[model samples]
Target: MRAALFQMTSGVDPAVNAAAIVDAIGRAKAGGADMLFTPEMAGCLDRDRTRAAATLRSEADDPVLAAVRDAAAKAGLWVHIGSLPLKDERADGRWANRSFLIDDRGAIRARYDKIHLFDVDLASDESWRESSVYGPGEQVVAADTPWGRMGFSICYDMRFPDLYRALTNAGATILLAPAAFTVPTGQAHWHVLLRARAIEAGCFMIATAQVGLHEDGRTTYGHSLVVDPWGAVLLDMGDVGGLAFADLDMGQVADVRGRVPAITNRRDIPAQVTLA
Candidate 1:
């Protein structure tokens, strides 16, 4: 199976963002991709989370989604339309960071809400308390796909390795981390963390990311990648806004499992603390 990872740069406009997504899908289809994955905050990446609330759309009336679903049908590919804004119950009209898996026939197979809220403080006086803007997901998701059971996660969730292990433990072979990682922390920890997840899970790790600047003047780390079960990078489109392509063999999963066997090597153990 072949997968396309879209490294996109999204701002505030829905129409413009959707058009860019259409173009990325075209490129991926032309490259013979069987599956395509876009990044987190897929439609619009705004600086003001409060203003972003006004743009959130329901699956029922989103024209952008309709067009993308149609494109998925036309290309006969499973499209992971990473994360979008779904209106929430908050009085301020917050949104849930959600992802949908649109099948080859244009059916919405599954939806995964981002479980981890990105509430962090960086050195730029740039701090995000995602909980103030969005609600956390109720559960971790591992969805059924044609290629394999694909585990779904958004940006900040990558910081937690146990979640990936749980997903892989539940029969997931393809792990997708759609991120709009910040330039600073991403430069320091992004690749190292992603590669570590693949090596630990013995699975195919696909990451579609946001590149360049956003409406809020925030730049993202956009080295989107596709790593194999053996921890080999199948393709890496470093800091580019385009499709990162790779042909994935389902058999290699078992091959890597046979070699490393980390899954079976897992053992329950007690925790230790270093603080004194």
Candidate 2:
């Protein structure tokens, strides 16, 4: 299956980002791609919680999502809208970092809200409290498509191995880790972590990322990647913001799993506490 990954530098305006997404979808369709993947916060990236809260809209009212779904239906493209910041009704005023999988007919096939909220202090000046504004999702979501079974995850979730394992156990053949990683962490751990996930899960890994400086005064590490089940990099879209393609071979999953049965070679050990 041919997949198109869109690396974007989204700004504070949802309309502008929507335009970019629409154009990328057109390009992907024209190139005969079966699917397109985008990055986290694809709707809008804001500098502060206040501005983000004021700018974001609910899923039902988001123009960006509506436009993308319409384009997907018209172009007969299966689109994975990486993640969108939307107002969450369950948490009163808190928002949701939601990912969507739209079918070729413009219907939403699956929705995965980001479970891991990024709340870290890289430095005094470069700290984020994502959990402060966005309520975390409690479920892991995977869905079936014509290509194969796909596992869904957003930025910080890439750091968690258990989630990937669970998805693999649930029959995921391909994993998507769409992100808007900070420059410091992305430079330090992005490639290593993603490659590790692919090797461990024995599944194709696709990561479409946000790049360059944004209106939010944040610089993202942009290196959208596609890795085979054997942990080989198929395509690495360097620090540019655009579309990159890779043809996925589902047969590679069985080939790698047969050689290294790591997923099934596990022994459960009871937890114990010992005095240090």
Highest lDDT among the candidates is held by which one? 2
Best by TM-score: 2
Across residues 173-210, which tens digit of lDDT does each residue of candidate 1 receive? 99999999999988898888889999999999998889
lDDT of 1 at 101: 91
Per-candidate Cα lDDT values, in order, are 0.85, 0.93
Q: Candidate 2 regions off by >4 Å?
A: 273-276
Taking the tens digit of each residue's C-alpha lDDT, what string does model 2 give over 74-113? 9999999999999854555778889999999999999999
Q: Candidate 1 has which clashing residue pairs, if any?
A: none
lDDT of 2 at 157: 97
Clashing pairs in 2: none
